[model samples]
Target: MPKTIDDLSTPCLLIEKERLEANCRQMQARARAEGVALRPHTKTHKMLSLAALQKSHGARGITVAKVGEAEVFAAAGFDDICIAYTVVGAEKSARIAALAPGISFCIDSLEGARQASAVFAGLGRTVRVLLEIDAGYGRCGRTWDDPSLVTFARHVADLPGLALGGILTHEGNAYQPHQAATVMAEARDRMLSVAVRLGDAGLATRGRFVISVGSTPSANVFRNAHRDGFSITEIRPGNYVFNDLTQVNLGVCSFKQCALTVLTTVVSQHRGAGGAVRFFLDAGRKVLTSDRAPLSDTYGQLLYHARTMAPHPHARLTNLSEEHGWGAVRGGSTLTVGDRVRIVPNHACVVVNTQDEAYLVDGDEVLNTWRVDARGHVQ
Candidate 1:
């Protein structure tokens, strides 16, 4: 049956099948050329179908943010997974041990290592752990040159039921919306130097150490690092699969490269006394999300139509309430009640979390539906 946005309900998440496939293939190609393994972060889309597609494209594995998410992917046959966030506490530790055979994680301290040791030992399994190094993101991890790094590494290596997988970093600060390339490159360099320094200090054991670093903005940096002999073993970029307004603003991907969008319908229109046109859409902060990048001032960008991803230069998504998205165009819009429009949200990850399923479309034809199966697995 023929299916389009008009034929479906309003405020629905949509994924362009062609663009998403191209994005995956391009990232894989770049990784192959640069000699680094691609283990794309699956926290953005969190669908087993897309995860399978990534694996088919030669990705080494997948990265998730939580143990629950890793369990979701693992149950779906994604054996190799990394919970990039720190793994602590008994509840999450037990969950991690249950899925520990093929899963790994990031840790920054000896205490976290001990926690894993206790739980995994009780469960009779070992867990691979990577040291999280701070590469200027400042969210987590010790600084690259911190004197205590080697001490913590040695402590983690000595712990029972734990294997030092390697080192990794999230250059999350590179999402500056401007100057991202330079910042991303610098973060990669810092992360690479730390890996080299630690390796030289005899931190590598059992086998060749895995030096992984990435974020959507710093994905190219991983390529450049590999080409420059930086010995980076893996890259974990999540947002590259569905470039949103944030990625577009950071210049990581063009609007045409973005694959995910929201299909919204105009519910009402109002005109100000000064001759301004304002329209309310069914999609609001609950649907599109309010995660704006540094400079972009809207929840999402307005696409002219569902068939075309082109944005109306004058149209802007100004405000969003629980159920209403208020937008304005400088001149006027011909849109009236029940008109459909597509919105490229600012953050595809957050938007995906707000939905249960997404329509997979190839051009104007709806091909299938993908469940956000791992959504809300934030534990």
Candidate 2:
């Protein structure tokens, strides 16, 4: 076993194994109690081992954002996978076809459906697809109440080598600056109304139709939505496995539930002309990331130490350069040049993608090292 954080290099990513497992259990239990399937999004961790752990905790399947990411997980033996983004182009569709027979993906427009259908047809297989409904998040997908939805459904039904499996949506607006419960309710009601409307169109009578909705901030609303008997088939939350400062700010999770942090060391310290102490860390926009939570302007929060994973509160990450983070000491924090600190980034998903590997830790003891095999698979 690796000894301590000293054995690892500076600015390394660390995953608190116990906290991660606990997070998985909590999400799984919540989904089960509400009688909904948890098909967690794997784009957060991008690690096969952790995805397997989620499966072990009763996830129905895994969700990825790209065909490249799906290939990585499928090669690692994850059979049921859903690409939650719109897939277009011949090359991407071909790559997606190779992973077929157990793959499903999202379709937001008729042209995408035609392209996917044509490509999969040439490969001699039918591809299952879920129509993406824009439930007022306004990012991607056709509007839920669009009169053209039935026309698109009819077109998809008549297309060769393309099967309309169900409807899917992401209530991403929940991450916006709003009361967590309020956004949750809006997300639940909007998506449920659309799902019910679509299900009544005779498509759901085929037994393959499903209504899926997810986003970590609105996960509880999904549970309550399901408990309210709206026939929500699956919940696809990704970041619940590693809560971040954003989730903490949204009240989706507490700091104790966050499972990942940047193990950074203080490399330099100096006082301004006004006699205020400022320290720079080895972690910066490259690792800790500059994703600011709407609730806080700080890039990240510095942890007290290994004995206490609690945020120091006094040491605020005020600014970030390419390879350095400037932290300000307030409330009488006496940080020194050689002090070691853990930083809980504003967003964990993008932070994990910045590194090639992460150290799995249980307290200060390094349990093992896992490669972030899909780090740059953004294509």
lDDT of 2: 0.84
| Candidates' C-alpha lDDT | 0.84, 0.84
User: Among all windows of ten consecutive residues in candidate 2, which has the lowest summed lDDT?
Assistant: 221-230
Kindly list the per-residue Cα lDDT of model 2 for residues 1-379, writing each as its tens digit.
4688778888898899999999999999889887778999989989888888899999998999998899999888888999999887778888988874789999987888889889988878898899898877899998888888877887886788998888888888888765555765766676667656656775554334677789998885554554233567788999999998999888788999999989988899987667887889999899987789878979987889755798886778889999999888785557777778898889999999998889999888898888887778888
Return the lDDT, model 2, position 230: 54
Residue 31 in candidate 2, Cα distance off native in Å = 0.5
Model 1: per-residue Cα lDDT over 1-379, one tens digit each: 4376567888898899999999999999888987778999999998999899899988998999998899999888788998899888878888877763889998887778788888887777788889998988888887888877877787887888888878888888878766567766776677667766666667773237788888888785544554233467888989999998888887788999999999989999988667798999999989987778657888788988767779878888889999999989877897888888899999999999999999999877888889999998888
Clashing pairs in 2: none
